[model samples]
Target: MERQLIAALAALALVAGCASPQPAPVQLVDQQQYTKAMRDNSSTFTWPESRKPDLAVLAEKSGPGRDRAPSGSERIVLEITNSCACYLGWEDARKRGDQAAASQALKVMDEVLPKFSPEDPDGQRYARETAAKAKAGDGSQAADYVANNCDSVLWK
Candidate 1:
């Protein structure tokens, strides 16, 4: 009975190890390496094709007031973060060879990027350059740009 119980526990452990996904690598040295790592382990995680966040509604729903409405500046920050999320998703999908997912992410990015307020020059530039790369079928530089510049807004 003791031997049987031990064997059963070992079998359960083996099954669990096989079923659980390995964690994504934490420290890639550069964008090219990062992209390679993501592609190699794309099956380890679910890459959701996210929608553009509606800033008006999001701002109205958050912040420090009874009305919970954020300031104009705060709203622009929200827009940048949300847009970057979509951008990252697009690049990630492209790396994974997932055309359908990449297209979905790009669609969201197109809708969100245009709405960035004129006050944000960096946001405008990122939108322009990344969108161009995405459409031009050269996503490597776009991914590198995002890694270098938009690291703050990148998803954890």
Candidate 2:
């Protein structure tokens, strides 16, 4: 009975370690500003309320109230620690001459990339930087780079 209990606990630990990581929860910095950023403003698409959490990794600038751009508008900012493994998986497939898998990965990236709305200047800048990183390599560390070395999506 003691051996069986120990084995069960070990199995539980293994399962726990295998569980997928959850995205960090996003917080609203300013309700009105967040609302303003969600509207159609200087972009092809209007920011949606549902996709706010998708905004993460970087902001347009530092200092107080950096999340807001255009004075009164705000974008969602989540701690960009987590990464999507799709980019690495895509790399593996291309390396193995697996065109079908590579194509599938491209599709996922397409779906994922547009989540970075270009409406906010910070979002546009982040999107551009992320695209550049995607072309460079596995692209997993792109957000880490932005968070560490860059500001939110501000214009030139």
Candidate 3:
């Protein structure tokens, strides 16, 4: 009886251990990673080489006295490209059951969109609304936003 009791308790402990929830994976999305992801989506956009964002300058904008943020059509291209990448990351995370990654992508969007707001309010508004829709699990709006906005650039 003593041996049987010990075995049962050990089995119960093992089962409990297996049933515990594992911590979700860490998926931090920094600016460089985000920038690369944005560039990856650039195939969906049409912009002149001069207008494409310089990754080094983009990485520095978060720091003080960094006035290198793009303006005019360049700024618009950056906004549309980042928004396209972010929306895709958000939806992919949702599909993969990685809420942390989705939220991180949105956080990156929040960090990026404001820098463009002063120069291009309309583009910022569109990107902001797309992020909000992603937070609400409405990915179709993001798709629509990217499709309708990205391809129409005149690339001057």
- TM-score winner: 1
- Give the per-residue lDDT of model 1 (tens digit) for 1-156: 122322343344455556669733222123233223333433332334453333333332222223211112243335544555666778778778999988887766555575466645776776777777777887775567556545433233
> Which digits, one per residue and each the tens of the lDDT, describe model 2 over residues 1-156?
122322343344445545738533332234245333433232332222222223322222221232322222222222121112344445556678888876665555555544643434674466455555565554555545544532333221
Stretches > 4 Å off in candidate 2: 1-83, 116-125, 128-156
What RMSD does each model have against the real structure?
Answer: 20.6, 18.5, 21.3
lDDT assessment of candidate 2: 0.39
Ranking of all candidate structures by their TM-score, best first: 1, 3, 2
Q: Note the residue pairs that clash in candidate 3.
A: none
Error of 3 at 11 (Å): 75
lDDT of 3 by residue, 83-120 (tens): 65566566667778887877787776666654554645
lDDT of the candidates, in the order given: 0.50, 0.39, 0.50
TM-score of 2: 0.29
Q: Which pairs in model 2 have colliding backbones?
A: 59-152, 60-152, 60-153, 121-153, 122-153
